[model samples]
Target: MSVANSVSEISPRPSIEGIVEITRADMDRVNALILSMAGSNVELIPQIAEHLISSGGKRLRPMLTLASARAFDYSGEGHVKLAASVEFLHTATLLHDDVVDESALRRGRTTARMIWGNQASVLVGDYLLGQAFKMMVEVGSMRALAILSNASAVIAEGEVWQLSAAKKMSTEESDYMAVIEAKTAALFAAAAEVGPVIAEAGEPAIAAMRRYGMALGLAFQLVDDVLDYGGSADALGKNVGDDFREGKITLPVILAHRHADAAEQQFWREAMEGGSNDDEALARAMELMARHGALDETKHRARAFGAQALEALDALADTPVRSALADVVDFCIDRIN
Candidate 1:
């Protein structure tokens, strides 16, 4: 049963908090399961895991899993397990990300790698992946396991690809898009798809969920990119210009580079590629992005993807859950607005 065509008929967006409220009970279960599964007799293992897990964030990925299962009317406990697995996968990635990025902060607090050291962070991440796979196995769903495992591999490839392409002036918009699709969107698609698969929802439903998540994830990351240039530190939970400091080749940089003249291009090359990214340089970069309307264009692209996500939601029944999910698309894009 596909409702893709009815997407245009759904009007108004709900609040993100409302959507979260709808899944609160299920999320509580997922949280408890996460805590239980993260435990190990190894002291540092649990310590690191607990540090990252207990830190404050929206927990959007696992919530997506739970809400997706609810949208499909799944009544079994399998969705709970899958939601925990999704969170474990997400947490593992964050641990590794901080190490790779040499990031000191995450979600307005010190990164696990910052306090615990890189080695402990990396090993704990591996432990979480081991636990994620175990939970997936416990679900008795081979297809769900395959989807998540494949996403995990693709995400790793995307990370390495981004590293190789970082701060390269020649990097195209398409190249960056492909990287985000894999690194950020693949797990989202898998997380949402697993819910319906566990529910034995048909192929069409699975496809719809995948599309919805893919588009939402794209919008989510694009907004994050925009926020890196424009958002306040309080809103971002990390310092503004983190992407600039890291020389990440995000969409804003790609757009600005395309519009820049030779001298402006030289500025980008020095600031981003040559690692001359001091505060003065970052200020100049922001000026360039504003001058070229890079931030506006990136937000426009994010809205386009947000619309795609909403359209994908039409494949499901026209229920409050679907409506709330649509609101999530709005909420993600609204971060930049």
Candidate 2:
């Protein structure tokens, strides 16, 4: 269905607040562990880490880890450590990503790279990775350790792939999907899968959590990509047209290019492929996307993935945790609305 149709069909549902409430008790513990683990005697390490961590971004990933454990009735201390590890891993990536993207703003504030410079950002990111692994080992689950470690490697590989593909308008939709799945979804899948593994749940439950996380991550990434072009800077916590300025080929660009006529294709080639980004240029590029329904179609794709995420939960028993998880899917997709 078209995104317009999908938007209208979706009933307003509970927001991420409900999920946070469900996981509140556990997440408080996770938050404490995150702060404790992020500490360092180096002073600069904690300084840089806290600069980003204190930002008002919702701790969605760690919450997912907590909620996943709760879903399986896993009442162990291991999930707490694992959840903090998940946050550190996520923070490390964001630090590196800002440097890679040369971003000035994140969560409506100056990025660490912008204030502390790229060298400090990169070093602190390494520090966070070290801490993340240390926490992982503390958990003492080889399976969980292996899952997150592999995800770390895959995330790096995805960043490299996207760097190579940057500004190449010829990039296909399949290629874009591959990049996101590796870079964004891999960690998410690991975060959810480790919960069930720690819980010693059966393979089916573990596999179901993995699938749910993967689909949710895909939906999340797609929505972020859509928002880069269409959302307000206030809403995005970063500048709009960032992908266009960076010449990053996202799904919106892919679908638009696929259907553009000769003249419109040439526009994309010059504006996006050539990285021509000014205010007027951004406006025109947005006009092209709207003219061709690229943004709408991207949102539709995200909603479809959100549906897949909800469907994956069917393998698990019904509970408030499950219901909250399902609502989280709706909340992710609702960002566009």
Candidate 3:
């Protein structure tokens, strides 16, 4: 059956405590390695890197690696390096994203780009990617290295693809999905898949982890897009309408645009092109979204992906790791509840 079509319902409110507690020991080592790898004599490199790395974000990508590996009873050290590499890849993307978005805050703190400058932020991000590749090479798994490296390329394409789609009313739902899958889900898939490969888990388990990660990534992005329109500044670590102001065509905006009539379409085009960017425009956007059921439909799709993520776990042994992975899905989607 199709994944989304097979989804039934979302689980209850979830907590990160399970995953964090389960992976505590491994995560400690991963954190140390991340810090060590981020070090550079340039002074500004480590300074900017540490500021964001320690900015209290969940570090969810690397945790996915740890959990997937531990679930398979991996006993070696490669998972640690792989986990840290996953984190480095994610952090590099964030630094680049902040620079591209001209963002002022991340996790409610001044962004690295804002604290240093776009030039510094971009360079430090490149430095992190270099560090990420170094960690992957140290792991000595060509398969894992290929997977993560491919994801790096794919994420770059996703960013460019999003720019192409930006501010264009012609953007489609498929275009938005493609962007999220490449930009967000690809890393999640890679982060999760590398764990099983390092553990030497069979093809079935490895494929299942990749599927799980991809679904989870899509779910995370969907919920994130919903938050852009409806969540609080404290919740988002930035303004609620940041996506709208940036002219990004997220799922909510895509759905709202897809369903609009002649005049409604004109309003959407105007707002998307930066002609309308005030509170009144934002309120009107919200009103149109509500009228078109855009937010509700977006949440529905997020729940479906969350369900797929939880379902993908059935391939693995039932244990704390599996339970925690399930909870992570809940953590991603239940916040919108």
Candidate 4:
């Protein structure tokens, strides 16, 4: 049965904690599964992967996988493999991302590149990608393989696109959205949708889960952008003006640029495209964003996506698992970092 049909037959109001509670056991099992999959294979690669994996970040992606599976009453062991594969893919991407961005910190600690050096980090990332594909093959599900592989491809494309487009004033909202979706939303959609695929969920349920993932992922990225503009360094695990220093044009900057007067626009254009990383120029850009209410507007959009994510969960029946998914959507918006 479709999740929409199931939900229509249940009570309209359900508690968020209740839904998630039903999946607690499943979540734990998946966590163990992921640890086993990532456990010490060789000395250096495992050490590097563990350095960042053990850092204090919520395992939200794998949690989504497990929860989505339980929401549909999936009882097969393949979900465990799928969940582990998702975490491996995510961690692998993070390793490469730190290198590409030359970031020194993540989750408030030294990044993989800083700890292991760039070459080690890159190779370990490639190792994790290999592990991810190997796990997918073990799962032996063509649908799951297709979803994850496509997501991996999209992530690579997004990274390349971002590298080429950063600091370019010609970037539009459409272009930014495309980049964020490919980089961030693609994996989220895969994580959320894979559960139903394992369970052989009906087409409508699959579609609903896909929408839920997309909206949730977009909300997550939007909030990340907002935090870049407004969050404290301690809260965000990086300098407050890092994006501006790097000349990355996130949503707040896009809005601020659009709202700026001729002189203000010129200032942004020069700071972004001129390869200037001066502190004063970054401060001026931030000031412009605040003066125009661009930051606040971006926050509103993030909240809207969060709300849409919850609405998509309405397709799921009045189950404890569904409510948990809703809570997660809410949590994404309120995340401090």
Per-model TM against the reference: 0.95, 0.95, 0.95, 0.90
Predicted structure 3: clash tally: 0
> Residue by residue across 1-337, what tens digits does model 2's lDDT show?
9999999997766599878998898888888887888888888888899999999878888888888988888978999999899999999999999999999999889999988899999999998999999999999999999999999999999999999998888898999999999999999889889999999988999999999999999999999999999887876778888888888899999988888999888988887777677788888878888988999999999999999999999998889889988988998898898
> In candidate 4, what are the lDDT values of residues 161-261, reduced to their tens digit?
98888988789988998999999999999999998888888888888888899899999898888887678766566777777878888889899988889
Q: Could you tell me the lDDT of residue 312 within candidate 2? A: 97
**RMSD to true structure for each model, in Å:** 5.9, 4.1, 5.7, 6.9
- 152-248: candidate 1 lDDT, tens digit per residue: 8998899899989988989999999999999999989998899899888899999999999999999999999999999987668688999899999
TM-score between candidate 1 and the true structure = 0.95
Clash numbers, per candidate: 2, 0, 0, 2
Q: Which residue pairs clash in candidate 3?
A: none
Model 3 error, position 186 (Å): 0.8
Q: Which ten residues in a row have the lowest lDDT in candidate 3?
A: 4-13
Please name the candidate that would achieve the greatest lDDT relative to the true structure: 3
Candidate 4 TM-score versus the reference: 0.90
